[model samples]
Target: MELFFFQLLNGLGLGVIYFLLSVGLTITFGLLNFVNFAHGAFYMVGAYVTFVIVSLTGNFWLALLIAPLVIGTLAIALEQSVVKFSYVLEHKYQILVTLGVALMLQELVIMIWGPIGKNVSPPSSLAGIIEIGDFIYPKYRAFVIAFSALIAIVVWWGLEKTKFGALVRAGSENAQMVGLLGVNITRLFSITFGLGGLLAGLAGVLAAPLRGADPFMGVEALGIAFIVVVIGGMGSFLGALVGGLVVGVMQSVMSSVWPEGASLMVYAAMAAVILSRPRGLFGRA
Candidate 1:
């Protein structure tokens, strides 16, 4: 039972990482109708940025603050130069362009940060453990849970209740119609992409202490994010959240029970879900 609980906690932590990374993917898909394949690379860049900032200042908090801003700016440039070309290209071309960019970004990360990975410690204040009866949990993990929950709520509220959210919903459903109403949908798309990049960056920064920083981290994280997006139904916010948690918990639990099959299990589960309902749990057909 204790082990189950521990795995559950671990799943939730990982799920939040998925959620943060996928939210941007979800929004970009939902709004721009762009199938972004380079989202994971954004996550990796954020982690590397955090490492660089921390190495220079020895302040984790400062890295947390600056990394996202820097990443967002860089992402905007990538969009203007590379990603924007996909707007008129066929979907296949878009995928090819983005995938190529992802590969190039990975190589760039290796050149800039070197091929070696680094383990980053949580702030000293977050190093202890907390007890619940006989169960003791690392305080840093607890911190992850709290931070992720806060972000989820804020995102949910922003998307579901605000005027901006309403505009996004309307624009996504019918960009041409929204543009006819005098809304500059191209501008909206830019903002959506920028916001998505920042969210991914924030997720990367949050993950740095727990997972360490590495160029390869982005590739793996992107796969998890892709799974989450697929499971939840592309473009559906609730789907992303529910899918992330479900996949996260299942993978953690399965890894504990059968290490060899851990990787295949999650993909198998996704296959099952897709077989049962072709459009995903919340996606449109």
Candidate 2:
């Protein structure tokens, strides 16, 4: 029973991270109809930026506040200058361009931060263990789960209840119609792109303490995020949430029982989900 509870809590923490990592990717796809393979690059940049900021200011809170903004602004610039051109291109072209961009960004990170990885310690306030009814867990991990959940709630509210979200959803179905309705889709696209970047960046910061800052971390996370997105259903916010938790918990349990096949379990789950529901658990046709 103790082991079960431990694994469940740990799984929830991992799920929250996956959720943060993939939500932005789904939003971009759902609203803008753009495939951005470079989203994970933003995640890498966010972690590196957080490391740099923390090193300079000795304040995790400051890094938390600024790193996402930096990445978000950079994403906005990229959308305006480069990605905008790919918007009208075929899906293959978009994939090629974004993959190229992702490679370039990875190389850039290596040049700036070196090939070595860096570690980040949790904030002093959160760097302790908490005990509850004979079950002990790290405070930082709990914080990660709670903080990510809070963000998830905010995102849900923003998208499901806000006017901008409605516009985005409507645009996803018929962009031409939304444009005809005088919605200024170009601006909307930019905002949505930046928002996605911001979410990825935030994920990076939250993950730095757990996974460390590595140039290849983005690539690794990108694969898992893709799986989560696929499992949850492309463009479905609820899908992302449910898929993330499911994958996270599955991986956690597998790691304990069959450490060697832990990674394979997520893929297996993805295959099963895909086979049963082509559109994903929460995805639309």
Candidate 3:
């Protein structure tokens, strides 16, 4: 029973990571109708940025503050220079261009940070454990879960209750109508894309201490993010949250029981979801 509980907690922590990673993808796809295969590149950038900042300042908090901003700024620049041109093109073109961008970013990271993975230690405050009765839990994992939940709340409130959220929703539904109403739909897209990149960067920073920083980390994360987006429903924030948690928990439990089939379980769940609800749990048909 204690083992199950421990695995459940670990699963929730992993789910939080997935939610942060997938939410950005969901937002970009939902509002911009752009498939950003390079989103994970920003994630990798964030982790590397955090590593550099921490190495220089010896402060995890400082890295946390600056890494996302740097990645977000880079994302905006990329959107302006490269992504914007592909927006009017077909999906195949978008995929090819974004995949190329991702490859370039991965190589850039390898050139700058080396091919070997680097470790990031949690802040001293978080590098401890908490005991609850007979079980002990890592403090950093708890922090990840709480911090991610707070972010999820803020994102939900902003998207569902704020004026900017309304504009984004409106733009996503009908860009022409929104443009006719005097809104700069292109600027909105830029902001949305940047925000998505910022979220991915934030997830990367959070994950660095646990997962380490590597050039190929983004590739692995991108695959899981796609599965989460599909299982949750494309462009659906609620779906991302639910699907992330489901996939996280499923994988965690399977790791303990089946070990080798852990990853397979996620695909199985996705297949089952698709067979029953093609649009995803919270996705609109």
lDDT by residue (183-235, candidate 3, tens digit) is 98889899999999999999999999999899999999999999999899988
What lDDT score belongs to each candidate, Candidate 1 first?
A: 0.86, 0.91, 0.92
Off by over 4 Å in 1: none
For candidate 3, what is the total of clashing residue pairs?
0
RMSD for each model, in Å, please?
A: 1.2, 0.9, 0.8
Regions of candidate 2 where Cα sits further than 4 Å from its true position: none
The residue-level lDDT of candidate 1 at 95 comes to: 87
State the lDDT of candidate 1 residue by residue for 108-214, as single tens digits: 98988789897777878888999989998899888888888898999889888998788888977987899999987777777788888988999999899888888
User: Candidate 3, overall lDDT?
Assistant: 0.92
- Colliding pairs, model 1: none
Ten-residue segment with the worst summed lDDT in candidate 1?
A: 184-193
TM-score of each: 0.96, 0.98, 0.98
